[model samples]
Target: MNDNTSMGNGASQQNHLNGQWQGQPGQQGQGQYGQYGQPQGGYQQGPPQGGWQQAPQPKKKNWFLRHKILTAILALFLIGSIASASGGGSKGSDSASSSDNSSSDSAAKSDDKKSDEKKSEKKDEEKKDEGDKLPAVGTPVRDGKFEFTITKVERGKTTAGSNEFLQETAQGEYTYVYVTVKNIGDRAQMMSESDQKAFSSTGQQFSTDTSASLALDGDNDFFLTDINPGNQAKGILVFDAPKGTKLTQIELHDSFLSGGVKASL
Candidate 1:
């Protein structure tokens, strides 16, 4: 009886110590199985693989629908900008062209005015220099670069009475004048029958008659001739006029550019 009582007391004491270890409600305890391998206090848990979730996608934008007024304003602003650029370019081009044309026209008119002014001044000077430009026959006149003397006047005559080849009867009566031209200039002087004109008393002018020129003998005509410096040309010019017409004066020119000298018949 003593051996059994000692064994029973030792077993009871061990049992009491084991119960103390499992005691206390709502106390710290070992982890139970749950999602993410975290502790769950006596609750049912899903599988660890089901804890993984896809992130939410961002919502797609509806830009036109979200800001209707801002979209309309941007569209109108773009159209206005395009229209203004186009119209401004065209207007600028037209303005530039017109300015260029106006500048060209102004330059042209300025040049023309200068030319006309120069011409007017030149003509005025020429008029001021013209003297002894008009005179009568039988008068000795001094013109530019030359001196003229009307020596004789013979009317109603065709040609001189040479040995042969004389035109005695002409279509109209003939008049003759003896003239002498002296070149007082430094250069050679030219003479032309066209430069000599016979004026009737009635103021009618006649050119030299060439019909009887061939029949006449002698170098008395001054056509197509030149006189050197300090030299002279003595010539006879013939004309045809109405019968009994009075030869009043003669006009002579040394050159086409010479002012000319006149002499009374």
Candidate 2:
């Protein structure tokens, strides 16, 4: 019985050693499977099955990339804003420049108008200055003569027996006077001899005679013969007055003699 018992104990020891060896192999296998297993809970939770893993799933998408897109949009917005500002500034500058130019033009026009007015005033002054340089008519001088009296002084006329001659006188004792003169002293003396002969054929004569039975208060006509030395002439006379009348001054002027002489009657 003792021998049998010892043999049984040795077998049991061998069996324990075998069980330990088997347990060690099983633990090693479990460690290897833990390091490289399929995903658990629907997610890959271990190291890669091949030599490398999927590069950490690329870190979801990445907020920086999204930020880049937003930044591009912002940049575009900035560009548009800058362009609009520049355009507005240019337009305003152009408008201001145009206004300034117009103002300058208006000022220039005003200056021209002022200059024209001044010129007109200067011309008017010159014209006034030119008007102060002429001569005026003067009164006359007289002298005595061989009993000269203006019988009839009137515009000249040519008619039978009165070709530029004094034809009528009053019924009084008087001396007639006829004077001929010119304005510029440039015309020839008297009518030609032929003209005088023709006038005489018409019973016309140039005379300064007085008659007792003559009719005055009518036209006294005469022809211009010559211009006096000073382009002037005078006719003076004396007449038989009504008993106690006094002699007076005489004045003479034009010939044929419309506007001839004035006697203080």
Candidate 3:
């Protein structure tokens, strides 16, 4: 009868522990052991379906990549700005070069025109110089104090001077040039035979033979004769030159120091 009573009390204590572990309503809590030999509230359970996991954190995107349209627009704008600046600079440089070339061309043209004008003026001066020629024979040329007119010329003579005592013989041949001299100045000028010169066809110069004037017959005042102003005198000039020498021109001067006037014979 005592053994039955002990069994009954033990069974009741077990039931009371199970009720506390199960967390029954209106039941006071107690530290209880589970069937797995662990504390009841501290027991660990397996994952429901898959392996163990944690809540995933979202990935962050690059700011430039996130706003693709804005980034692309900014890139395109930069590229276009660079191209425009480059094109504008090139055009400006071209314009400046063109301007410089134009200016240089204008300056060159101006210089060319000046050169052309100078050439034209030179040509005109040359033509004027050609026009101002010396007068021919019988055209009345004047020196400083006398006006002379060459009348005639004679060539090929062996001797001169009609006076046998003062007569002169030619070393070469003798030529005679007849001229009329008129003094136009206020004072009398002495006509000098030595101041006259004769040129041949080949430009050979011949001087007058003053001693041959003594051989001349009749009114020959060629020997250092002084003529008053407004008076005229006839003179003969005798030249000693080679045989067959043809005198083409005669230069007559009023005095030895005077610049002569040339007349074609």
| Higher-TM-score candidate of 1 and 3 | 3
Writing each residue's lDDT as its tens digit, candidate 1 over 88-161 gives 99999999999999999999999999999898778655533432244545567887877888888888874444
Score every model by TM-score. Answer: 0.45, 0.29, 0.48
Q: List the candidate 3 regions with Cα displacement exceeding 4 Å.
A: 1-134
lDDT-better candidate, 2 vs 3? 3
Model 1, position 46, has a per-residue lDDT of: 73
Alpha-carbon error at 15 in model 3, in Å?
99
lDDT tens digits, residue span 1-265, model 2: 9998999998988866654433234233223234354222234456666766446555566765769989888889999999999999999999999999999999999999999989877865653343222111122222221112333322222111233353443333343333332343344333111111000111222223232112232322222334333454333222333322222323443333233333321
Question: How badly does each model clash, as a count of residue pairs?
Answer: 4, 8, 2
- Which ranges of candidate 2 are over 4 A from the true structure? 1-69, 133-265
How well does candidate 2 score on lDDT at residue 172?
35
Q: How many Å off is the CA of 111 in candidate 2?
A: 1.0
How accurate locally is residue 35 in candidate 1, as Cα lDDT from 0 to 100? 34
Model 1 stretches with alpha carbons more than 4 Å out: 1-138, 159-168, 219-221
Window of ten residues with lowest summed lDDT in model 3: 31-40
Q: How far is candidate 2 from the true structure (C-alpha RMSD, Å)?
A: 20.5
- Tell me the alpha-carbon RMSD of every candidate: 11.1, 20.5, 14.0
